[model samples]
Target: MAVQDSPPVPPNVATTGGKLTGSLGVGSIVFMVVAAAAPLTVISGTVPLGIAAGNGAAFPATYVVCTAILLLFAVGFTSMARHVPGAGAFYTYVERGLGRPVGLGTAFLALLSYTAVQGAVFGYIGAAVNDFVVSHGGPSVPWWVWSVGALAVVGVLGYRHIELSGKVLGILLVCEVGIVIVVDVAVMVQGGDAGMSTAMLSPGEFLSGAPGIAMIFALAGYIGFEATAIFRDEARDPARTIPRATYLSLVLIGGFYTISSWSVVSAWGDEGAITAATDNPEGMVVDTAARYVGAFTGDLVQVLLITSLFAALLSFHNVLSRYIFSLGNTAVLPKQCGRSHPKHSSPHVASVVQVATAGLLIGVSALAGLDPVTEVFAWFAGVSTVGIVALMLMTSVAVLVFFRRSRVDDRLWNTVIAPAAGLVGLAVMLYMTAANLPLLVGGSSTLAAVITVVLVATFLVGVALAVVRPPATVVEVTTQEEKK
Candidate 1:
C-alpha cells in the first residue's frame, strides 16, 4: 500500500504570504499551552466537582492517571511532529497517515472542539467578571457584556504577532500558578486537617465512588496541552522546540493538578473534603484557601480566576485561528482565510473569523435566554471534551499506521508501543466522556443525545465536503534530509 503525505511547499512562495512567523521559544510555547489548561479555573471549579460528584478524596489520583496516558500519547505525537509539518497538528498528521478525506473530517472536528471550548470559556469568564464586580458593590452587569468585552480584547491580541499573545499568557500563567502554589505550601506546612494522608493514591481509593466521572473531569483539565504542535510555524527550531514544549506542558499541568488537588483534599481531611465539596462545590477551593493561607489569598484567587479564563480564551483563539488558516491555505476554505498580515506575520483573517464566530455563539445563547455558565459553559464544554478526546483516539491510530507503513523512525516505543497504549487509554476516555455526557452537561440525557448527533453530523459534513471539493495540496516540512 502506498502512503500519503502532505504536498511540499513550492520553492517560490514568499514567507509573509500564507505562512505564519514568530520567534516563540520553548518557554513561550509552554506558557501558551499550559495557560490554555487554565490551572486556577480547574483547581477552583473542577476540583470540587470532581471530589463531590466523583471519587471523593481519590480525585487527585485521576489527574495522575490522565497525565500518564497523555504522556504516552505524546511519545508518538512528538515523534510525528519532527517529521510532519504544518499548523494543522491533528489534521495534518491524520492526512499524512490516513487519506485526505478522513484527515479533512478530523480537521472539521478539531475546529468544532476548539471553538466550543473557547465559547465555553467566554461564558465562564463573563460570569466570573460579573460576580466579582457585583460582589464588590459595582453596578449589576450581565455576563454576556463581560464576555463580549473579553472577546474584543482576545480578538485584538490574536490578530497581532504571536509573540505578543505568548508574553501576555506567560504573565497570567505565572500569577495563577503562584497563588495555587502558595496555598499548597500552606497546606503542607500546617500538616493538613488529617495530617497529610496519602490514602488518595491507593488503588482501592480510586475505585471508591464514581471513578468514571472523576476520570472525565480530570481529563478535561488537560485539554489545551496537545496544542503545542499547532504553533509549529511560529516556534523557533520547531523540531526540538515542539517536542520539548509538549513534554514540559504535560509534566507541569499534571504535576500541578495532582499536588494542588491533593492539598485541597488534605485541607479538609479525607472525609471532610467530600462533605465540604458536596455542600459548597463553588466555594470549596476559595474557602479552603481562606482556611489554609489567609483571607487575602482567597480574594486574590477569585481575581486571578478571571485572568486564568482570559488566558485560556486567548490561547484557544490562537489555536482555532491557525486551524482555519491551515484549512484555508490547503483550499479547504476561502484562500483569503489563509493569508497572514504582512505587517504582523499573523493569521489576521482567520483570527477575525474565530472572534466573530465566538461572539455569534455568545449572542445566540444570550438571545435564547440560556444561563451563561450552565447552558453555554457546561453544555459546550461537554461537547468539546467528547470531540477532542475522539480526535486524540483517531490521531493515535493514525500515528501507529503511519509509522508501520512508512518505516519512518522505526524505534519500537515512539512508533508502535506508545501510540498503541495511548490509543487504548484515549479510547477508554472517549467512552467515559460519551457515557457521562448527561452528567457533564447538567443531566439532560436528551441534550446529550442531541450533542452526540450534532458532532457526528459535523464530521460527516466535513467528509462530504472533502469528497465534493477536495483540499488543495499543503506543504509538509520534514526534520531529516532524504536518504539516498
Candidate 2:
C-alpha cells in the first residue's frame, strides 16, 4: 500500500496569504518594535531586582550596549534579508544561509517560542482585565474569557492590511511611550525621593548578581528587533527600509527601557529603590508615579498598562502568524499558510488558525488550576525568552555564513565578528535562563528544573511534527484552451 494524498484541512495548519509588498515605512516598523517592548516595561519578569542590579541610572547604558549588539547583528542580518523574503525570519535566514535541515529545525523552534509568547501575553492580559473588572464591581470572570476575546480580535485584524495592524499598534504604542515619559519626567522634576545616589552609574552593582544577570535583562529589550528582516516583504523597500527600521527600532526601544527603568529607581530614592521594587515590582512603577503625580495619575497609568499589554498581544500575534505563513510557503507547512489575502495582502488564514490555537491554550491553562500571573510567566514567557536567545544566536551564524563569500564588502566586521560576538552573548543568556529557571518562574530551582523540562518537551513535539512532514496542497489551475 502507498500513502494517499489527502485534501482535508490539516490540523494545526492553514493556508497563508502570499508574500507582502515592501511598503511599510520606517514609522510602521518602529511601531512594531515598541509594541513588542511596551508590555515588558510594566510587567517585568523580575521588576524588583531590576532596581538593585543594573536598573538604576546605568540601566540606560546597559540598554545602549545591547541595542548596539543587536544593530550589529542587523548589519549582517538585513544584508541577507535583501536576498531572501519569507515569513519565517529566523528559519528563512538560517535555511538560505545554512541548510534545509537547519531551516526546518529553526522553523519548529520559532513556532514554539513565538507562539508561546503569544499565549503568555494572553495570560497576562487576561489576569489584568479580570482584576480590573472585578475591582470595578463587575462580575469576576475567569481569565480565559479575556484571552479568548483578544484572540478573536487579533484574528480579525490579522486577516487585513499590514498597514492597518501597524496603525493600530502605533496608536497604542504612542500612548504607552507617552505614559512612561510622563512618569519619567515627573520623577526627575520632583527631584526623586530623599537622598539621590550616583551609585547607579557604578559598574560594581552591575555584576553583583552574577555578571550574566544584567546582560540577561538587557537582552529582553532587544528581542523583537530581530523581526525587522521578517517584515522585509511588507517593507516599503527591502534594500533600504528594512535595515533602517531594524537599527532604528533597536535604538528607540533600548533607550526607552533604560531611561524608564532608571526613572523608577530615581523616583524611589536609591535607599528604598530595591526594597520598594522588591515589595511591589509590578505595581512599583505605578506607585513611583503616584508618589510624584498623586493617586489619580498612578491609577491612570495602571489602566494604560492594561492597554499596553493588548498592544503587545496584537504585535506578537502578527509575528507568530507570519511564521505560520512562512512555513507553508516553504512546503514544511500547508500551502494555505503561504497564501496572501487579495484585498488585505496579509496571512488571513494563518492568522485565524493562530487565534484559534491561542484561544485553546488559554482555556486549557485556566482549567489546569494554574495561577495566570506567575505560572504563565514561568511556563510560557520564560520559555519564549530562552527560545529567542537561541534563535538570535542562530541568526547571527546565518548572517556570518551568508556573507562569508562576499569579500568586496567588509563582511569581516559586519557579517562575521560582530554577529559572532552577539551569538556568544545570546548563548550566555540562554544558559542563564535555563540555570535560573526558578528565578524566572518566581520559584525554587527544583521547580524551575521541572518547568524547563516541560518547555523543552513542548519544543520537541513541534520538531517531531515538522520532521514527520504535514500533507501539502496540490493546487491545480485551469485556463481556457489557448486560441490557436
Identify the leading candidate in terms of lDDT. Answer: 1
Error of 1 at 276 (Å): 0.9
- Candidate 1 lDDT tens digits, 382-463: 9999999999998998899889898969699999999999999999999999999999988999999999998988888888
lDDT, candidate 1, at 478: 40
Clashes of each: 0, 16
Q: In candidate 1, which residue pairs clash?
A: none
The 10 consecutive residues of candidate 1 with the worst lDDT sum are 475-484
- For all candidates in order, the CA lDDT equals 0.89, 0.69
